[model samples]
Target: MSRALALVFTASFGAMWSFYLLLSVVPRYATSHGAGGIGAGGMTGALMGATVAAELAVPRLVGRFGYRSVLAVGLVLLGLPALALRAATSLPAIAGICVIRGMGLAVLFVAGSALVPAIAPPARRAAALGVYGLVVGVPAVIALPLGLWLAERVGYAIVFVLAGGAALGGLAALPGVPTRTRAHAGAEAGRGVVAALRSPALAWPSAVFSLSAMAAGAVVTFLPLAVARGSGGLAASALFAQAASTAGARWWAGHHGDRHGSAGLLLPAVLLAAVGLSALTLVGRPIAVVLGMLVLGAGFGVAQNASLALMFEHAPPRDYDAVSAVWNIAYDTGLALGGAGFGVLAARTGYPAAFGVAGALVAAALVPAWRDRAWLRPVPDAPHCPRGYR
Candidate 1:
């Protein structure tokens, strides 16, 4: 990796850690601050749904403004909500801030992902993205456990303030990167959002990305609660195990994807994830819960990195903004739906049934993996340009 990639990866680390910290704590914070069980979960789901809506709108924002400008705007937007969380005394106010925060997150992720393919060499794109995922994943693994710990030691308000400051730090790194505005100018002029949506390459990966994201969404929203039930107590240990396994898997798979093609890793990744989910059904002991979480996290890391790399591989360079937007929208929408639906289902049938259902859906993802070998053909002799123009 070059210095530029290292900087981007560092920025990603700050941004993701902040984002994950807030996501991990907000539900408990909401409940403690006044909102109850279902309402707290609902607010979390609303945050995710709002992000899906924001992702749908981000491409236009990036087109009109450049990527760096859009990134700056997202950072500002993200920071405000983190600060606002300190003052949110009611459910309605908290929900509103969640929406604002979600929009900011959506813009930041789409812009950042668009920048990744542009910066990486054609042959190294998957590997580069894998590293990017690993950087982001590390914080994700630690964020929840750390947040829970911080909330216990300090307060949620202080946690939000720290998270906001870290996000601002990520914004500070933006100015150092070389710009790609000139290269994207022609594509910006020629394409409309409708034309971008009509492309099969965009739609297919978006669908697959959405499906893969559902499992992760369920874990983020409900896994802690599930662990609590299985253990007859809540343990921070489960969060640590899940995060550690996920970060390790993401780093390993990213390097693997770079050495071998992403297609080579897809089937096994999904299969492992499905197996992990199935294991949840039989987890009656504390050790079993931790083992199940590790399996689940590893599977999610592989699927997430592989799927995103496949999308970039198949997409045209000029379409990076549109592709990132559409793919993220699919992912966020699935996340929201999975979180909300599983929350309700857990209330009805129980965690085991909910985990089983999510597992079944994940298992079905293999159908696409089998067909992806044909679907995601390698890019042929494409010119490598640092400016991101094809």
Candidate 2:
């Protein structure tokens, strides 16, 4: 990979690691502070809502401030929440920190994603995105388990400090990247969100992204609780297994998307996710849960990379900010909806029924993939391109 691409990946890895670490510890911290399941779930939901709000604003922010400046600000903002969490002794205070942290996550994701496409050559864009996803997945895979372990050994405060340090590390890497300024940067500056909705090509991939995100949200919010029940207690082994499966699957799927066109992989990835959800519904056995988690993780990783690549490839270069906003809105909306809706559903029915409903929703994602497969054809060449032109 090129040096620019490497830097993007490195920065993304650190940022995402910090985000995941906080996510892993938030529930434990909440419970320790006397919050229950509903309260914990609400905090997670609030975080997603905050991210959506930030995503809605990112296009304008990127236009006004530029990507590099936006990213730097985002990294610093991410650090603040960690410090806030360390001092938070009440549910409202913790929720407020989550909201702040969510805003930082929103900015980082949008700026970083938009930056990747600008820095990468068009011909290799998909591959570059795949590599980027792989890098993000690496730290994500370990962040949760490690965070949980550290929290258990040292305490949640220490985990928050470590996560803050990671955010600082990511911020330190940002200055090394060269800034890209678009030609129509002014005209394109405030148009990303609207343009994304108007373009069916961009919207379709986002739909797929949203559905997959929903499945992931379910797992993240409830899998630990489920495991605790199944094991008769919360064991480190279960947490480690879940984190490993998620991270490992993401890394592998990113490579798969890089090798094959995203369209070729979309349906199968969605189907695999559905199957994983189905497995969880059918059998609550520990080994089965682990296996299902692996399937779900792989599907999520591949689908996310593929969908993002598809959106970027179809989007006009000038619309990067808008496109990034659209992608994040879809993803966070899915997460928020899934966490809140599934929590209600699980309460009304049970974990098995909740898993089944989630599986069904994921299965529905394949319909659009099948129908829109041809819509994602490779970009046509300019009239006077090279000899390999078809």
Per-prediction TM-score to the true structure, in the order listed = 0.88, 0.89
Which regions in candidate 2 have their CA more than 4 angstroms from the true location? 182-190, 229-260, 365-374, 377-390
| Alpha-carbon runs more than 4 Å astray in model 1 | 33-37, 185-197, 229-235, 282-284, 365-373, 379-390
* Candidate 1 residue-wise lDDT, 97-152, digit = tens: 88988888898788777777777777677777777887888887778678877887
* Highest-TM-score candidate: 2
Model 1 global lDDT (CA atoms, 0 to 1): 0.71
Q: How accurate is candidate 2 locally (lDDT)?
A: 0.72
Considering summed lDDT, which 10 consecutive residues are worst modelled in model 1? 381-390
lDDT of each: 0.71, 0.72
Residue 168 C-alpha lDDT in model 2 = 69
Clashing pairs in 2: 192-322
